[model samples]
Target: MLIKGYDDGPLVAGEPLMTRPGFWSNHLMGMCDDGAGHPVPEWFGDDGADADALSEVLFDPGHWPVFRVPAAEGPGVVVVYRNQPGDYGIDYLLTPPGRSSTEQLTDWEGDLAENGLTWHELVRIADTPVHEAEGAADPAARLLLVLPLLNDLDLPAAAPARLGAALAAAGSPQDTVTHTAESLLAHLMGRSRHDADWASPLSGGY
Candidate 1:
């Protein structure tokens, strides 16, 4: 599952907010500020800043690379792609200035069409209630539950379940449960995937 949005303003009613340029930039970058006056990174390939020059590289119908950078001033861009044989595809997200959060999310969804990438929006789990089960007491079990949920939310399958387990195992065992929850949250937000070295926080086991 993949989840992407920008940190701008709140989506307004009756106004199409997804067309903003900042939303495009933030959506491509995968991370945006929470509308709290934070910085956004620049486009990866706009000026040959280490991004491939081929527009086809973004929609080749295969597995591709993901890119991310620290929260900085100016513009920010992030992209995630799959590198399957004979098929390469990429997703673009960016954080432009003066937009709402919902607008940013909507733009990320819209960019799929603009960039010719195939994808589906994740279903909202706000109705899924957290129950008190034995697994809730075991971090590993909790992590497992959360992982699948994030997967349901469109996070990549390569997310680190083992890391969630380890984080669950390290502390008071109960603390692991929280870690698992956090892991699920991170995954939903495209933060911790094993194959996502370019953007995965788990790249260094953190």
Candidate 2:
């Protein structure tokens, strides 16, 4: 959740929750093998970084940073690398909000065939690591990239694609849609069959 930290409440698509920040103990380092004898900037850590510090690294072209995207339930958190790690275009880590349990999503490698994603297309997307941009962690853009996979999983696009055209028309190509926190929450509650029942539709009904 960026500098504000996790809300422990709930998260929905297009809600603009901040991605997980890189850590000194938990942050990502530069992946380039500069072969420099001295320590590269990528070797450093910024685990408990503040907003201004994170902003600096996020916009720096030299770093191959990792960004987080919260699952609609918030119980699961998805972490992705902005740049390709060699032939693979992206790297991912899945865990709970606090990262209690972790799973890496490297299926895009041999698992691509099973998941139905084209290696060529993935490689193309990887070529331009979103982290290098100012809005590297834009919730809207992230949704577009991962939307196709939502149905197979237990998640939702809090903002939904209904606003895709409008977001694009507004000139933010990275943002697939725009949504308010309440809208996202409502979207999740209305559409997520798995999670919708967490609370009764009419708990207050007589």
Candidate 3:
């Protein structure tokens, strides 16, 4: 269910119209003129113009676009926004149960504690080693580090082992890591049940 901006209103709860095993979360943000001369908020100061534009396009209701992604476990909010000068941005905000009325770091911290580690420890384990690389690092390599850490901490695994294998085969260790992190997040934040409802998309297919 979707709740629009700046209002305190009741949410009509029901099963989602469609249920997939996993999906992407997209959020939109950016700076634009809005016909005014002043610049909108700068996400990266000067390097965020494209991001801003993307946000505007995604959030413009006239287009009435609904993002479709793989299904996830817990409840989440999809955020889309437009900035000054007509820029846009998009991303998914996972809203786990009992975390908070508003999505915030405190909610994240609470989940971290619910697992075996403090927030600091979680962050430390998730941190990537500093290195200069030509392109983005492979996600699977990062997953190798993350999955083990989450396992060691007794955190619930979000993505199954199959997803990891897919990342490994695709040559993106970081994607594997990202998939693992998402799974961990889903598990900690209470989305695992939802994940279980769908046939494992990454199952043997991965």
> Regarding TM-score, does 1 or 2 come out ahead?
2
Pairs of residues at least 3 apart in sequence or in different chains that clash in candidate 2: 13-158, 22-27, 23-26, 23-27, 23-47, 24-45, 24-46, 24-47, 140-176
Residue 124 shift from truth in candidate 2, angstroms = 27
For 112-141, candidate 1 gives per-residue lDDT tens digits of 221111111111111122233111223232
TM-score of each: 0.18, 0.31, 0.23
Q: Which residue window of length 10 is worst by lDDT in model 1? A: 117-126
Query: Per-residue alpha-carbon lDDT of model 2 for 61-125, expressed as tens digits?
Result: 34444444444333222434333334433334443344444555332332221222222222223
How many angstroms is residue 77 displaced in model 2 relative to the true structure, after the best TM-score fit?
A: 3.9
Please name the candidate that would achieve the greatest lDDT relative to the true structure.
2
Candidate 3 has a TM-score of 0.23
Model 1, residue 115: distance off in Å is 9.5
